[model samples]
Target: MDALPFALLLCGVFLFAGAVKGLLGLGLPTVAMGLLGLAMPPVQAAALLLVPSLVTNVWQLLAGPRFGALLARLWPMMLGIVAGTLTGSGIIAGAAARNASVALGIALALYGLVGLLKPQLRVPPSVEPWAGPLVGAVTGLVTGATGVFVIPAVPYLGSLDLDRNDLVQALGLSFTVSTLALAVGLALHGALPLAASGASLLAVLPALLGMWFGGWLRLRVRPETFRRGFFVGLLLLGGDLARRGLA
Candidate 1:
């Protein structure tokens, strides 16, 4: 495929994904991964989304309240992220393209529903200790393969009810550390090439802008309403991708 078209498509997609991330704090990878996986290989898709995901969420962490407290509480969740990334690498390197696309598209569609429907979805002060390893492992497997693994954990994480500031802070830290681990794993497997890396990096500007736009739009709507829009959009996008894969 022509790199230009893929790159162009990514910029447009990230505009929406970043906007969603800026408002809700975690839609970048979910949306971008689903769209990219249609053309890019899974590991390559992970690599492509990793950089922008980190860059765009920085706004949230920097401005968030109680950032340190949230970080302190997230050590276990971070552990899960690491484990999930490592576990996911094996799957990414091996997953068939069509299968990976369908799985990621479906996962993205589901998580978008959670974000659209849940008025209260953020991290809590306390969560199940075992939740980290089990959930993280599954997320990591999906992350390595599809970059959509984070969706499974989003509902639980989103329901934290930490207000907007601490919520984004927690997610920034979470995605940053975990996506970094995923990048390492992909690099080790030689999946992080110059083309994907360049595209991913180039994507950061639009991603950040989109996040800012979404954040602005967020102020205009209720959380559940935003999530509903996000969910419907994902269902449409996910359905399209699934059908294409089937075809």
Candidate 2:
């Protein structure tokens, strides 16, 4: 791919990703990585997602009022994410980097299946102290390996029974930290070059535009409907990723 064409493709991808996040309050990085991984190596794709993911998710995290409470509750998990990312960054940038696309495919497929199932698992408050960090560590490892961060994190957060806004903000907080951690990991591994960083920064513009559009559409559409459609698309994309990886 020529530089201009690649940048254009990235703009389109981020625009769609931002729209998804704007409407649902999550999934920007997941969508970006999944789509971009189709054309590039997963590590490079992950690197490109850093700037837009961080910027948008920071907006999502702070736009709400429950930041203090969520942070208080989630600090341990956030700590674990950082630790896991630092620990696993080497694998992600080295041997595992080659297989990252396949891993991402598996992660996406699992995420879609779980979303479709919509199981209601309750987490006891007593278990959270232990479970939070465990889940965060695992999610961080997955993010390190595949550039997809949802996995157990989304379901675990849902298990907490937060209000809609709180859930959104919580996801934003988790993803913001994940993005920062990923950036550091990639930087340490020398995977983030100046050109990619510049392109990622430029991508912020289209992503924001798409977010605005999606936010507008969110008011008119049933979110559940859109969510179902989103997952279905993910399932198909996951299948494609797996196929390409196997080829």
The best candidate in terms of lDDT: 2
Candidate 2 Cα errors over 4 Å, as ranges:
none
Best by TM-score: 2
Report lDDT per candidate: 0.72, 0.89
Off by over 4 Å in 1: 116-127, 219-224
* Candidate 2 lDDT (Cα, 0 to 1): 0.89
RMSD of each: 2.9, 1.1
Which residue pairs show backbone clashes in model 1? 84-140, 88-141, 116-227, 116-228, 121-158, 121-159, 122-158, 122-159, 122-160, 123-160
User: Across residues 137-181, which tens digit of lDDT does each residue of candidate 1 receive?
Assistant: 666666766667566565556665656666667767767776787
lDDT at 51, model 1: 83
Clashes of each: 10, 0
